[model samples]
Target: MKQLVRFFIIGMLVSGVLLYLISSLNQSQGYTGGNTLTIFNWGDYIDEELITQFEAETGIKIVYETFDSNEAMMTKIEQGGTSYDIAVPSEYMIDKMRQEDLLIPLDHDKLPNLKNIDERFLDLPFDPDNIYSVPYFWGTVGITYNAELLPDKTFTSWNDLWDPDLKNEIILIDGAREIIGMGLNSLGYSLNDTNKAHLQEAFDKLGTLTPNIKAIVGDENKLLMQNNEAAVAVLWSGDAADIMWENEAIDYVIPEEGSNLWFDNIVIPKTAKNIEAAHAFINFMLDAKVAAQNTEYVAYSTPNQAALQYMDPEMVADERFYPPPALTEKLEVYQNLGKRNLAYYNDLFLAFKMYGK
Candidate 1:
């Protein structure tokens, strides 16, 4: 009977040890189903192969989604109570997110690979001191012209879009800020101007271009340009670059008066579910080698000076990718205009469409 009692005790102890090991294994496996990192970004902006490669290297699954505009993205995130690990948004929108208290402060120390970034692109007014975001790609909005379509004409300034020759042959950027800003730039006014007269003048200027414009577009400029539906368009540098590959006749030019210098950055929202993984992803992309590859593939400017050294000289030398030093000096980065100004800007755009037509 004592021997039987000893056997029962030993079996119970062994079962307890097994139960403990099972519990530990379950905990180590992480929350219930599995771990997935969700990324929200603009469409066609990253290399899928690179994402796959990142997943393979890190053992983290990447689930990516895209939105066409910052407002839409913000709304969805707010409404859905969405939990995303990382997101890429443009400069002004970053300020909006920050203002809304929708973003989390980044721990730069967690991103050692940030050393690859050029100091010049760091510490902008939007994310001063580089505390909230990391720039992933940089570009300027510029005029993309088909040299074959208008060989005789020289296009130099935003005013050139008003040329009668471009009538029904040009495309304007769809965003009110860009279209109005172009007009404002042409009129020697600040792009962020809130004064009624200045905005009216911008509206008038855009009205003049409207008769000439074939379409107002969001992201279809490259396709339209490639197919010859658009002879000239104001386009993002990367989009222009991608189309230029298939059609060498296309050329990109920054308006002589100057244009906006913009950067899209990786930011972790306050609602992020996986902060550590987000940092890991940012650090991974910030690697000079990785940045070089991404910049080359996406045909965008790198904010990474160290990455530039590792990039092909052809990419570095592409005038569209890296404008002349003098042009760079004249360029301005956009800041988030306050809410009242935003309402005014929207009103101006509506007026343009309603009466300027």
Candidate 2:
């Protein structure tokens, strides 16, 4: 009986050793059992497959969440119930977040792939030196029109949007800065003009466009344009590109008067619980091939210069989406106009919406 008991104990001891070795091996190969990174981003902004790839590669699970608007994202981060390790926000919002101390400075040493970004995108007015952010995607706000519907109309300027023939045939993106800026740009004033008189003039000008405005929408604008529901739309370049891809009849152009040149960048929120994993994700996204794949999926202009080689040559060559330096130089980036001025812009926009109603 004693000999049988000794054999039984030896067998149990060997099994325990084997289980410990297996666990250690799995961990070394990036099989982290509880590691996770939470991301707050714009809806439909990333390729879902990449999330799976990242998790498999690093064993760090992703808790992906999305917001439809920058304001909504900011509000949630400010509320502080959940700890988000990463968030994507536009340039102006990044400026606001930095001011509010809601972001943490990036450690460049961990983000070695940062060198892949184009020099033109870095050291910009917002987040100068990119202390708190890295360029994710960048594009302009402009007009997209259906060639089949407006065969005779070549929209080369913002003023063309006010054409009488276009009445009740135009869709506008639902954003105060974009719509108000369109009015401002039409008047040949700065999109960021903070003057009371200029703002009122812009407001009045938009009031005239009420007759032409078909509908104000968000993501649905793409579907409307694709289905030939609207003749023209004021859209972000990325959204325009997606629409054009679906409907060959669709064409996009930046008006001669210039418009908002915006940048959406990756940032680390102050409430990050997995700082290391956050850095890992940033570096993973910055990889040239990964960046190319993402831009291809999202239909956004990438700031990853090295990634261009991996992108479709014809798509990259399209000047409407990739404007020349001369044109880009003329474009304007939105600035944080402070809370009161921003509210004023929103109020004016709301009043304009009501005017249309």
Candidate 3:
């Protein structure tokens, strides 16, 4: 009898210990009584310190994930493999997601800090009334050239990239919309031109510049330009700013013929499981000081007007990155061309790449 009683007590004690450990594990994973906010964003796009700070202050855990392209991000979200509370996608992608009902309309009451965003960045065509997205960063696509390598040459327009002197010296960003848009803009056609004839004309024109195209690249374009491996590159303003900061000989220009103006915004995906925590995270990031710090770290143009007070005055005054309303209004924002049109653009750009090779 005594031996049986001892065995029962031992079993009860072990069960209580196991239950305690299980409860602790559940709390850590946010399964039972904790909050977790999952975020999908671009790689190296944010100041990670902010993530830690947010978690510390709000007691909400963060599950951060990154993607290299909008298409990749969209595919993963659509797959329903993981529930994402927030995603930062380009304006065009935001429109695409909205049309497909892959996003949830934002509740403004939870985003009082929305007032900090610049008026110019709000009410955009992609998310009218700021219902589905809020602007994170805005920048122009333009040329960044090593002035030391091309002492006498200046790139005032996209046509300059086709100059014989620049043969085999230019690197273009590897994006169908951007490169194709460049060809279109150079011909005085809309970057978002849907006219097949016009697009063909642009494609044929791009073929003529094949000799001047040394390589088509993505993020590595920044590294190549900084190392002076390429004399000229079609690059985004924020990336140009970063490269120029590292290389004194580098300079950026917005072509006279105009170019793309892109906006990346934050939104809630349809798979969001923690809506309240997501809103808290958004409002936390929109705070003036936080936004300023994030922009400084990422070297991107901030769309939070209130954050300007906390940023360097000189950086704010650089028109190339922070152009006045007049110049920005002249730049075209990418439209959400349907899949067919988008695929057509991609196909033409692929042909252009092959022609260059």
Q: Ten consecutive residues with minimal summed lDDT in candidate 3?
A: 26-35
Model 1 scores worst on lDDT over the 10 consecutive residues at 26-35
- How far residue 46's Cα lies from its native spot in candidate 2, in Å, is 1.9
RMSD per model, one decimal: 9.4, 8.5, 6.0
In model 1, which runs have C-alpha deviations exceeding 4 angstroms?
A: 1-35
Which lDDT tens digits does candidate 1 get at residues 130-202? 8899999999988999999889977888888888877788887777788788888899887777788998888
- Each candidate's TM vs. the true structure? 0.85, 0.85, 0.88
**For residue 74, what is the lDDT in candidate 2?**
94
Query: What does candidate 1 score on TM?
Result: 0.85
- Clash pairs of candidate 2? none
Q: What is candidate 3's local distance difference test score?
A: 0.91
The number of the candidate with the highest lDDT is 2
List model 2 lDDT by residue over 1-357, tens digit each: 999999999999999999999889867765453497889999989999999999989978888899988999999998898789999999988988988899999999999999999999899989889899999999999999999999999998999999999989999999999999999999999998999999999999999999999999988999999999999999999899889889999999999889999999999998898899999999999999999999889988899999999999986898887888888887899888888999999999999999943
Model 1, residue pairs in steric clash = none
Best by TM-score: 3
What C-alpha root-mean-square deviation, in Å, does candidate 1 show against the real structure? 9.4
Give lDDT per model, in order: 0.84, 0.92, 0.91
Name the 10 consecutive residues with the lowest summed lDDT in model 2: 25-34
